[model samples]
Target: MAQPALGPAEAEGPCSTPLESPVHPVDEKPAPSRLVPAALQHIAAMYAGVVTPPLIIGQAVGLDQAGLTRLIAASLLIAGCATLLQTLGIGGFAGNRLPFVNAASSAGIAPMLAIAETSAPGHQLPVIYGAVLVAGAFCLAIGPFFGRLLRFFPPLVTGVVITLIGVTLMPVPVSWAQGGDKEAADFGAMKYLALAAFTLTVILIVQRFGRGFVRQVALLIGLLAGTLAAVPFGLADFSAIRSAPESLDDQDDGEGEGGQGE
Candidate 1:
């Protein structure tokens, strides 16, 4: 094959050599009308994400309803604080200064559950929290060098890991279907199972029949419908909500407890 000669313009162009910065130029400001709608969507996305990890881990660890509530409240507080810092860090001393939702993640659930099972009954939560703290510190320590490590994790490896995460998590929804109060004698009773089925049906119905915002929030709608449906079956528990802490300080006073979700 003949070697192609570079033209005069090609030789002089900026593309002749590699560019360094990867950041693309973007509009600094968005339409004012979009702000509220964008914020609402963010809240919607964060709703399920912020709740699931704490709910699952707390329940799996045998926390009572009060304890579970506290764990979830704490997770929400931490996620909110982290998100704010991530979006508005001063002088790049912390955070990425982006509108990123920093919330509890589901990735570490398996490991945390393993830790809970291995630890003595009463000591489960403390040991698991210690492991989490150490892991977070390790991640911070390696943050600057993490880019180079990505070379070892190509698309195929990442895809497999994601699929495994999904597979490993399948039991969680099943557990939810049974009943939140696993210790109750009537747990997984026909009524509870029927409620779960109805909730799923509602989700599917909305996805298939609704449009726009209704479809977008099908899961949430189904959840609300389920809660309402459960009232007649004596599955609803309103005392938890009534007794819930009024403020962060209240939740703090009750905290002896803690999920990874999104």
Candidate 2:
């Protein structure tokens, strides 16, 4: 059945009325493409950082280049695995969906060094591992109970904890600025200081002036620039990375019977 056509004014009324159209809210979403690439670049930047500490420590403990290389490889592999677990999350593990790499924290250095002096030959690595294992267990033991204790932490206590964290972290920046090692031949050299300054400048510049992709990749860019600047000064070494083996047995835990680097 056909109806009479509407007048121009009546037809226009429906089109002009704001309520005539069903409105849906639009959300501005960030581009996934940008985030994915930026994330990969971030992973690339942290790869070296995750591997280098074990290599340096192994060498300090008198491990051969091969053994140190193995330690480096293990460190990288473990960190990658931990990161995967943290990001993807198993049944009850993992912290968040964001990437999170784990390593032997520097906070344990003083304790480890103290243990090293008294530990028997080839006992260091095992001792370190054992300590780490125990620490994890201790955390597990205390976590739920400690979480409940959060109610007791008032704002003042929380603020004090935060202040303490800042106080502790101040030394870390100073150490990096002066070069990571105190015994290095060029420790506190201008070259090292310049590298640190350049790194800081890169981060500041990227944060201040960069947009989108550049901003997302700020950390990677800063690290890369800093490393590259250090390369000509012989600060970067691929020697350990290249020689690193896939086998765990190649590294000697601090135990003499356990093997080298111990």
TM of each candidate vs. truth: 0.74, 0.55
Least accurate 10 contiguous residues by lDDT in model 2: 21-30
* CA lDDT, candidate 2, residue 18: 62
Model 1, 39-141: lDDT tens digits are: 7777776777789888878977889877787799999999999999888886846788777888688888888888988999988899999999999999988
* Candidate closest to the true structure, highest TM-score: 1
Clash number by candidate, in order: 5, 9
RMSD of candidates 1 onward, in order = 8.0, 9.2
Clashes of 1: 5
